[model samples]
Target: MLKKIRWMAVVLLTGLVMYPLPLMADHQGAGQNSTLVLEPTVVTAGRIKEKKSDITTNVTIYTREDLEASSIQDLSDLMLKEGFMVREYPNSTISVAIRGFSTDTHGNDLSSSVLILVNGRRAGTGNLAKISMDNVERVEIIRGPASVQYGASALGGVINVITRKGKGPFTASLEGTLGSWDYKKGTVSMSGAVSQFDFDVTGSKSSQGDYDTGSGSEYRNTGFDSKERFSFNGGFTFLPQNRVGISYSDYSGDHIGSPDYLSANDPDDYVNHGIKSYDVYYDGQTRDDFLFWNIRYFKGKDEYETHDGAMTPSRTYWRDTDSQGAQAQITAKWAVAQITAGWDWVDYEVSNSNTVAGKENTYENPAGFFMVKTKLLEDKLVLTGGGRYDEYEVTSDTGKVKEDDNWSFSCGAVYKITGELSVRANYAQAFKMPTADQLFMLTDYSAWGMGIWSGNENLKPESSETYEAGIDYTRGSLTGSLTYFHTDFEDRIAYKSIGGGVTQYTNVQGGTLDGVEGSLQLDIGAMFGWDWEIVPYGSFTTFLEYEDDETNEKFQYTPEWSAAYGMRVNHVEYGLNARLNFTHYGRHEITDYEGTGATTLGPDTVADFSVGKELFDMNKFGKIRLKGEINNLFDRDYALVQGYPSPGRTFYLGLNYTY
Candidate 1:
């Protein structure tokens, strides 16, 4: 491990040394300004709009243009292709890991250490596949503890999806696509502003048959019958400084085949899932622009059903989850300081039904939080601090109740070394409450000599304290960042198998995780004053240490290293755009389902390329374009998860029209 770490560090240093620094001569006669441009703005880092360069945390943003240039079908696809640490199954189940901490793809929203938000509210589902990207304007990801801004389930990080809003003149678009494995997709969207009212709406549907592996063999039951989505965002501005808006989204997947692992192929298992969410909000500011405030209320539902037709009598299991929440916040701005305070309340109810008796559980939480940001030294040094307190209650149908409370805090600072460079460090404390299933579970198996499986109401919430430091550099045609982080985790909840065939949940000593993450990008065309824009980028993560304290064993499913490299091209004169990227995952350990011990999985790499070109434009009518994509260019046979193999080489062609 030490040797590997040293080798990676040496390689990174060599690359940095070989890259040329920005040249003043390149900009002097190019008719371009030499001044640095303001970095992109983000809201998830501070719970308010702020320049990315000013934030004391690590953040990644993906704009609509970036999405359009990719061949991804959904959030899961995007994350996997972008080299984010994730485990995806053939049935569309995906789990994301950040800094060695992960979310549960099959668990409820509240159970995950990572949080997913839509427009700054809970998405109500942990499955990324259920979140459609068709109506997203952008995505903001904060890669560290965020409990001070959001409440629980933000121990690892946060992913916020910001939907599109209407602006400019009325416009509409229609798109259709065809791909391998009998895949078909169609979409329609309209957006515009009329007087004080603005709106954006979109609808899409897609279907696919089973896909083949790299060996040209069919991976039976690895496709979905159909998937449908609809989303709308609209608002009315009653005053110049105030607006009332509403948003709605719906997603459904019908007959999604769930194939067993390659070792245990079961062809008669499948699942159906659906998710719906809606929210209403009012945003306003004082006439002087010194005070800004927002209030919102949201509700959502998630349904999941699975069928096991291979059983003698066949069995079906179903779960329904309902969630509702409200949030209000106010911010006051001054010359060199800003303050924000907020309150939040939410409730979740889940019910399960199957061949056995039905069961129901409820969880409720309320919280208050505050944050302050101050600048000094001629705005070259920025400081931020925040804290939150939450009280929660849980109830089960078996007349059991559990209550708990927690507090989180964070502090950070950023210091500008130069106009184009900065350094930052942060410390944050986060926690995740015990889930209802872990606190109130009760099952009897003594008749079969399995004794009892029970939960412990005394279990405490898991907690972590993280420290991170990083540097950011942004010069003409060049951008880069590097960060190092360490986390101390404690009181992790796990099930223990005691003697007498008894199993019970309890809090156990946790572990530590340390890693380094970095990214670099440069635009060759802009640097040399060429006619076209050409950019090359690369990013990677290397784990220094990740292990459990109790057994001194490394965590499962976390690779020692992962990387992504790509290049993008654009020619505005010809209305042409292209992208080629490769994502690589290093060797990792995976749990052996067929045995009690663990097993190691080999490394794998996947490549994708996409290109689009404008065909023609008819005045008063619309513009037409054609796009093509090839995924798995090398046709590599690999599995992200132990048993679920990813599809092989695939091709797609699409036609789009806009007015």
Candidate 2:
């Protein structure tokens, strides 16, 4: 069986590396306004920089333009458009399910196993992986075990957010919106360079009333989310072969959570807590003809609070999270090969008040690791391999606990077939150590008497081995990628409540995921006075669970298939912008059939969208612009999660003026 599996992996890899092509074109992108496009671009793939084509892992990127056209209101709005991803928030919260591996289809859980970053810095949230886009430039999402690089949680991969930077002597833009459900939003940004030192700053605010479910209930979504943010990113070349840069960002926000099945009009609506965060980072690089060195340090803090009173059965919990870390690396490139070696360390501390216990408890975990990357075959064939050794030190407020050790590594290569096409393949072995709650939680009474449970010191970390292959093709006006990936997971850890508010997290053995994704874009030159951009995309995902009898079954919250189609048009001076998109999601199992949180068919989603725009040229020294958007344009009502039905027809109008 091992030999057969190995052979299949080799064949799949060969197919991608041997792509056929006659001609290819360049990809159109930003950064042309000023910054030189560096070779071997550094993308947030595994918290590491890599060439786009050389990336052998499963990943996705959403640029500023993509977000603008899609007009994503929040994380769910963004994930919904990425056909390869699955998102559901049964209780008006959101979670991510990538490549068929997911904890809950519901979005409310912050502990979804997906790690999130801002400007290469970590942010904190309890169960839900939440982020703000006040000054976001792009978001890169990588899937599969990332514990080797990002530390705890990242068992599912990582989401890295890159912020905006200055391009010229001075630049500024402002935006605001008014829409249904008493919605309103406003944003401002300014940036410029003085000498060789450049900087960018931004701030935004927004709010919305309850959206009527229009589902025969008085239920209205009562989410009023607002944020205030500021960030500065600057870098300067110090010596002939070195540069130093630094960034600092801060944010505070509050939002009223909408009840799952109730209308906003209810006087007894339960309010979910909101979050606040701050981050700081410093980076430096030194490169000579033969050797290179890079280093970075990051620190972040997150606090949570409720909008209404103190706490209750529904409030369930209260908490604070803080994370601090630093990493450094030294590498060299000789004629035959390029090599890299690095080290990283992080510390995480959480303080919480358990709902049932009503007693404050805390947990602290610290860890460290090392890794490397390389190449071979006269540079025509590239190969990379790295390993990480980390120790998890867990401590409780009451006493000391056990320690866990993990070793992880990845080996992959991409071969150039033609300048326009390339096929690549890689295999990785990784592991995820259990979280504090998974190993030390004490039973709590809640949720219709579901017995509460705690963690197990004797528990073992879950492990996985994944193999993937992909082909990338690019040509004038078009670019695309197709990938096939699979992972065999052992000892999946999950939190479960037996009944009566009591809960205990445990591990179940034997799981696997298989999926394929293909995305392509076509841009047409000026036609009918408009520049046209069209994209057709799709992804297929399925998870197999080895039941108690070791029989393969369906995993929860993972979709069988999903797809999307989009069209966009743009005109220069007149500033006419428009887009239309359609997305479809196949069936998914909500939870285990006989275990907890079970469901027959998790809700599927089919959405349609359209937006239009126009811009007014500068008026005297002031500029004015107008825009509009109509979502669920057809008034289609759907559910992104089981009980959490999405919004109905909604429209937005915006006006902005600048001096």
For candidate 2, report its TM-score: 0.83
Q: Pick the candidate with the highest lDDT.
A: 1
C-alpha lDDT values of all predictions: 0.87, 0.59
Model 1 lDDT tens row, 211-297:
998877788888899999999999999988799999999999988889887667678788889899999999999898899999999
**Clashes found in each candidate (C-alpha, N, C closer than 3 A):** 0, 34
**lDDT per residue, candidate 2, 1-659, as tens digits?**
45435534554454344323111212223222222434335456534456777676656777787676545655556766665455444233456656664433222122545666666545554223245566678888776666666655565677777887765667777888888888888878788767666777876677777675535344443555554555667666556546566776665555555454432233444434444444334344444467666677776666554333333545544566566666676656666565666676666666666522333233334445444455556555777676777776766645547687877777788887876677888887766666666667674454545555777777787777888898877644445676777778787776665555556677777577766666655454411112343333333333333222234667655666566666766655555667766666666666432243547553345555655455556655666667777776666566655555667777888776654
TM-score of each: 0.96, 0.83
Q: Worst 10-residue stretch by lDDT in candidate 1?
A: 25-34
Look at candidate 1 and tell me the lDDT of residue 338: 98
